[model samples]
Target: MLVDSHCHLDFPDFAEELDAVVDRARQAGVGRMVTICTYLSRFDRILAVAERYDDVLCSLGVHPHQAAEEIGGVTVERLVELSRHPKVIGLGETGLDYFYDKSPRDIQQECFRRHIRASVETGLPLIIHTRDADDDTMRIVREEAAGQPVKGLLHCFSSGRQLAEDALDFGFSLSLSGIVTFKKSEELRDIVRDVPLDRILVETDAPYLAPVPFRGKRNEPAYVAHTAACVAEVKGVDAAELARRTTENFFRLFDRADPSRQAAA
Candidate 1:
């Protein structure tokens, strides 16, 4: 079984035929997925999907790019309060993105801190997003996690070895997406091999970062098998083993999944 730790099924890119997309994922051995909420206002859209799909889980938080768009739902207290929902298993898709800077950098940092605080308040993992802001991201990771302990995973990671090492050292996990399957991902491949299997998770980050052969195509949880294959090839392991290990690590990190949910699905 495989689990796509991050995807954006709520995005309009999949709105027309989302069920067909998910069906393809199950056929591809993707047993589970976690659809992300980029803006707190879209929480209901993501939540409805999680409630609709027995095998899908969702997170509640604001994305860095959407930080400036009236994030009234992601205040520290509000995040903690919403996390109380049974279907909402995690605290974010939050972090920095200096590359785009679509949202104010300072606001992004404040939103990131709120998520970390919420994670500390609620025993849940954080799904972080970072780009061209590695230094600030790692610094915030340490500073925020230091105040109160929390577990998190860097989603769609595309950083250097130092960032990976620092994240691991800080007790964070690293999730690889289809980007590792791209032609220019050699450096990322090396980093993938370096990350401990138990500390790794696989994602599709769909509607973005589509893997090779499917490059430039609309990605979904199903395509994670390709990313898994790419990671296994880099690490000199079988794809099934990679799938099994990553699936195990996925549940280990997102421990809120009930055994009955697994059995029911």
Candidate 2:
């Protein structure tokens, strides 16, 4: 079975059809999903979603885009505190995003560092979101990880091969999103082909970036199969094997998520 390692089920896009969305995911062989909390203030809503669905786990942190708004509130202490929940499996869909510049670069870096510290303290793998800031992202992850060994996954990775190589060197996993299925993502597909299967994971980042044939449409966890199939084809492996390997990789990186818990669900 496949696992959608990152998604935002709390988003209003799925509000009325969450049950149906999840059912579709199950029917598509997506046995589990991890809903991401982009803003700490709305964590209760995110947590409530996780509590409602046994197969849906979650992460906590402030997205880089919202860093300025969460200043003084996105503390390592607060992140560690919220992460104590049994279903909170990771930290920070957080990292640099120079593409949007939604928040000042410095503030985003500071917030990213705090989340990394929280991940180190909590022993939860960090869920990173990076775009057009590979140098800074790499430097911060490498610097902070040097002080304290940390585990993390580069979520929705669509960066340069050098960044992918650097992150892998730091012992981090790369999660592929529906973007990789786009026809223009030849570079990304090349990166996927080179990445070791054991260090790969799959996600939909649903309500956005739906895979091919479903492009320009609202994405859901069920569509992870298409992304997985694309990655599998690029890697010269069968879809089922890719699912098994990515599921294993998911559990390995997000160790806080219990496999038995999914079975029980």
Candidate 3:
């Protein structure tokens, strides 16, 4: 079964047909999904979604876009406390986003560092989002990871080769989103071609960036298969094998969300 390692299921885009959306994902062979929390204030909504679905899990932390708004109230102690929840498997959709500059760069860096520290304390994987700020992102991550190994996924990765190499060297996995299926992502495809399959994961980042066939339309967990298919072609592996390996990679990295534990229960 394929796992959508990153998505925003609590977004309003899925509110009216949340059940149907999830059912479609199951029918499409996506067995699991991790909805992301972009705002600490709205974390309750994200947690509620995860709690309502056995196959759904979540990450807790602020997105870099909301850093300026949430930073005043966010604390490593608080993030750690909330992350104690059984359904929260990872931390942060947090990282630098220079592309939009939605939040002050310094604030974003600080927020990112706090999430990294939380991940270290909780031993949970971090779900990172970096766009147009590869250097600072890698710099901060490397500095914080000094002597303390940090495990995480670079979600919706469409960055340059240097960032990819830096991230892999830091022992973090790269998650491919629908953007990899776009026509202009040749550089990204080339980067994936060189990446070890074991370190690759696929996601839709839905409610956005749908794959080629579904491009320009609202995305959902079900479309992760299309992203997986593109990655398989890029890696020259069978699509099923790609799915299996990425699913394995997901569980291996996010060890707290154990499928075996679910089955046993």
- Candidate 2 lDDT by residue in tens digits, 1-265: 9999989999999999999999999999998999998999999999999999988999999899999998679888898898999989999889989999999999999999999989888899999999999999989987887768899989999988999999999889999999999999999999988999999999999989999989999999999999999999999999989999999888888877866655786
lDDT (tens digit, per residue) of candidate 3 on 1-265: 9999999999999999999999999999999999999999999999999999999999999999999999987898999999999999999898999999999999999999999888888888888999999889888887887779789989999999999999999899999999999999999999999999999999999999999999999999999999999999999999999999999999999988877866776
Cα RMSD to the true fold for all candidates: 1.9, 1.8, 1.2
How does each model score on lDDT? 0.89, 0.92, 0.93
Report backbone clashes per prediction.
0, 0, 0
Q: After superposition, how far is residue 181 of candidate 1 from its true place, in Å?
A: 0.7
Q: Which segments of candidate 1 are over 4 A away from where they belong?
A: 258-265
Pairs that collide, model 2: none
Q: How many residue pairs clash in model 1?
A: 0
Candidate 1 per-residue C-alpha lDDT over 73-153 given as tens digits, one digit per residue, 9 for 90 to 100: 568888887888877878889999999999999989998988988898897999999999989998887787785678899
Rank the models by TM-score, top first: 3, 2, 1
Per-residue lDDT of 148 in model 2: 81
Better of 1 and 3 by TM-score: 3
| Model 3: residues with Cα > 4 Å off, grouped in runs | 261-265
